[model samples]
Target: MPALASHRKPRSRTRTNSPAVGLTTAAIASVSLLSAQSATADPKPSIDEVQKKVDDLYRQAGSATQEYNRAKESTAKQRRTVDRILDDVAKRTDSLNESRRALGSYAAAQYRTGAVTPTAALLFADSPQAYFEQSQLMDRLTEQQRSTITEFEAEQAAAAKQRAQATKSLESLTASQQSLRTSKQTVQTKLAEARELLSQLTAEEKARLAELERKREEEARRKAEARAKAEAEAEAERQRQEREQQEQSGSGTGAGSDTGSGTGTGTGTAGGAYAAKAEKVLSFARAQIGKPYVWGATGPSSFDCSGLTQAAWKAAGVDLPRTTWDQVKAGQSVATADLLPGDLVFFYDDISHVGIYIGDGKMIHAPKPGANVREESIYYMPIYGSIRPA
Candidate 1:
């Protein structure tokens, strides 16, 4: 009977322990809830902030791409120069060899005759110019022989100068090549970081961000339209005032008047007679409306910013440099008020981007990678300058 009582006491203690274990589990659940709340309290950047960062990354990449383009242009120019110098050197070398052979034969003839010829005496002179001044050889040699000597000396000197230029150009080319590589790597790095940042967002976040971009673009388009309208009206008013003034002065002269026909839709080639070449350039740009943007590509299918402008001007029979830095100097500088359909508009403080003005305060350009060639407001970015390519 005592053993039975001991076993029942153990069962009673087990029931008491079960209640304590349940309370302990409840405490653990409360702690987990508190931890989750704490984590949710931390702040994250807003979508607008993220969008700005991504935009900045893209701008940085664009800047680096321009650097690459500049380096590529430099390298190409240097290579051409080096090739020209090498060709010139080869031709001069052949002429020098021929002259030396002729002189050698003349020396052999004099040796056989037991009388040194003036050609041989001229050879031992301090310098070709000095030989003429000091040697009796000048009086003895035929004019033809003297001319050959003079021509050979000149050719030899030119060859030496060309060789030196080739070496210098080659060195410059190497440096430009290195700079190109560095710029390429920099662009890649910036793009990679931007991609990584974009990858972190959820689909919904991306959609929202895209919506924001759309709204911003819409706003920009509205502003551009307003500006274009204002400019057209202001131009018309000025033209009217000028015509009235000319009538009052009894002068039929039509100076200082805006001659560009209606600020037409960016697609038409109908500006005016003076803008005939510019119209052709704008037509070519309009035809490339939906092509993809590619770095360092200048083609019928794809192009970078400067590449697009260069190609457009080339179509109009005006050859422009391949990079924005050089292309900026390809034509007459124009003020913002004087921008015409064929003007090349530069962007950014560094002038890394270029677009062809297509009237109505709009410009057509290859905006960037992952974007298509299209027309946008000239005010979309800060203007550096404008040049009329035709």
Candidate 2:
């Protein structure tokens, strides 16, 4: 019996140890699989790749900033609309109160004079129409009393309509405020992401990244200069050809010469006027060259891309829309080759960025957060189009 008990204990031990060994083996397999995955995982991104990602994030933030600007502008306009609606409602309410008082006076006069009480008459009558019928209670009232009742009804309707409008406008204002909050959050998130990505880099990596950006900007400048030169040459060639045609057709003489000179003078005058405004815009932009790029600011201190352009144009006596989307539609669409100083040059397919053209294919702009208002080549990003705001 003791041998049997010992054998049973050994068997129990074996059963327990077998499951533990199986679990250990399974755990080891999992560890091995995880190790393989870790070994095959993608390597860390290079500094250049990090820079590209950062740039993309900034661009996304710029888009969100424009959305925030649009929402803010809408909210302001909606607030003004709501104020007007509320004011109208107040006026209507006053008028409604006066109408009610007049009706009450008429009813009291009828009651005192021993005629049918207005409320009693209305209750006994089949409907409001019947109560106001000429053959019914209205027949007992003088013209003034009858008119008062009609006026009261009209005033009541108008007051109700005004109240409805006020309610709708208030709702719209609330919606706009919510939209503004959402847009602001999107901008903040994008900017935070960009900052985090940049913060992850070592100091040496950041320095290298800056050098990479410098080289990229340099290349962009070179391309921009080359494009400007090409466009200028093409324009000159076109003028030369036009002159040759005029000379060959004898259109450069007498009346034709006078007409040509008149046209030239008009063009020169217009050009001079534009040049003056352009100078003002450029001056304003240059003054803001060192200001930090704030997402939604339009100010003496900091600015976003569209804000900078809007402020600069405002300084030049032009009112540009607050967002890049609206500003793009605020002026004459100009070709890239036709871009002149003071033109609002937009960037990105979505038209999220804008800069004041400073000629020579360069633009003064508030580039992005972590940067400042400065001049850079237009070719720094994809060009959407240009607008002659003047």
Candidate 3:
């Protein structure tokens, strides 16, 4: 019976496509290969590495930001200068036109009177004898001719001077425009590179990095507070010693005491009465706390390091230079030991960063992008120098 059943036609089996079989094999192989590759892939960067990389990028961006700020400042200055020059040029052009009209009128009048001939060619020649003859002949000239010649000569000279001035100004404007373009390109390039570096990280890495930055800033704040406390204590001690010395020697002089300028920093009386100008500057800076740090922004809202300092001083009626390079040279240099509130403290070997000294060891600064204006320890970074602006 089994042999007979086997011999009978078996139910037709459902046919599988040969291509489907091959596809299944290929998919399996592809997945396996991918798995192997992933298993052997290089490990991701450690948090430390990522942190360092982010820090480096931030520093680079900071440098670039300063460059951008300087460029923007330069551009703004040049624009104002250009505007002034253009305005002068326009006025000069009008003057020239007026001169042309005046000359034209003189010529038309001369034509009506049967144009004056050589009249005094030899007299006007550039020779001593001609000069003498011209002086003698001047008495024979009509008042009308003399006035027309004098007006024409004066206008010609003025027109010539204006043309020369306009040319020089045009040249200066061209140079400034070139500088602006260069600065803009440099800013764009640095920002783009920074963005690219930041993009290399995964979302998790970025989150961790941000957390790290927050912790660092927190540490800085704590250190600033501690420093401020220590400075206060030191100042109190100094005053006590000064009083003792005065009592011991019976001297009228208060040794070890500050000038009481209210600008004295480190433990000496900060928050004292800063100069009215300096008070305004400090007020402006304080009001700007929490504003974002934008590279080239000199703002009612955002600012770079130098921009913050510059704007603050400007509000105080002082025109500080636009960049750290120039700002560093703005006023008298003060030793770090003698730094005062409202003083401009510069950082880095390149003098790229700046902040306003707020007494003790704290300073108000626009730290960097992703950070808002905040008071931090001046010693958070290596300080290059300090300057007194007011």
Candidate 4:
């Protein structure tokens, strides 16, 4: 019987196109195609491309570091608020307990005097309004007793409200803490990516990258120097024109001499004050050269972009904000051409990086991870704008 069945054409087996089988076949084909495409994918990036990618990663990390700084500041402020709220809540709670104790003593006195039943005294202590609704009990209570009950109710209400506020503030603090953690992670991840990319390069490739960077920086420096020179010449021309006008006016009539002299003196005095502060700011920044670039750090040892600027300005007796975004808004905005020593030079559209301008188109800054605080041309990065913090 087995031999007969084997030879019977396998019962004219039917071929059905099952959906799962079809899907599996299609998926296999798709994977094969993807594999083939990947095999023919682009070759390794060139050194220039690698440099660009690493630079972009560093820029991304800088932005994330700023976010971390902002989140950290917010978290600290929120924590302070929470602590203050908790203290207020604690005091309110203590006051509430004190009022409850007063009510209890009043209830015990009433109970002992036989003026009211124990149950009624308990009700008077628990629910002052309800107990007062009873005219007999209300009439029997002394003014002092009524005052104590009112104060107890007020304290209880205040305590409840404060507890609610504390709860809300705690929730906000938790959220800010989470944001801080996320931002920190983002910065770390970006920096790790940049470091990994750099690690993959050979010594020759690394040297080439460094050379490229140096050339780029040098070109930027040249352009910045030219710009500074041009601005200086224009200023000189403007001053010359003003002097000539003063001389001509004086020659015609000495009437406007005092006013012109006063204006020039006032301008000179203001310029002198700014230059003095700027010298201090630049001196402080120069002293910090070669320090490591540490994100979120505002110290003598290390610093981030904004941190260095903030610390430098602080040395000049100017209080700057912690993050670049805020620091960008801390003072009057100035054109890049008008940037002078001590101006806060913000970079990138989001203003995530900052530096202390030290004149001659150079700025002292804590550049980025794996780098040290140094002076570079303002044109090293795209300038968003400038701020005169003083």
Per TM-score, the best of the predicted structures is: 4
lDDT minimum window of 10 residues, candidate 4: 258-267
lDDT score, candidate 1: 0.79
Over 1-390, each residue of candidate 3 has an lDDT whose tens digit, in order, gives 555545667788876778989899999999999999999998877877767766565666667666666656666666676677678767766765665455445334333443342323322345323432444644555676456556645655766776676677667667766766776676566667667767888898889888987887777678767767766776676677778878898885756544454524343443344466677888999999999988778898899898899999999889998888899998989887777678899988878789998877789999877789998888777899999875
User: lDDT of all predictions, in order shown?
Assistant: 0.79, 0.80, 0.73, 0.80
- Pairs in clash, predicted candidate 4: none
Query: Model 2 reaches what TM-score against the true structure?
Result: 0.79
lDDT of 4 by residue, 89-134 (tens): 8888888777767766665665565666654555544466565545
* Poorly placed runs, candidate 2 (over 4 Å): 1-34, 37-42, 113-135, 227-270
Which of the two, 1 or 4, has more TM-score? 4
Over 241-334, each residue of candidate 2 has an lDDT whose tens digit, in order, gives 6678888988864423322221111223336667778788888889999999989999989998888888998998999889999999999898
Residue pairs with colliding backbones in model 2 are none
- Name every residue pair that clashes in candidate 3: none
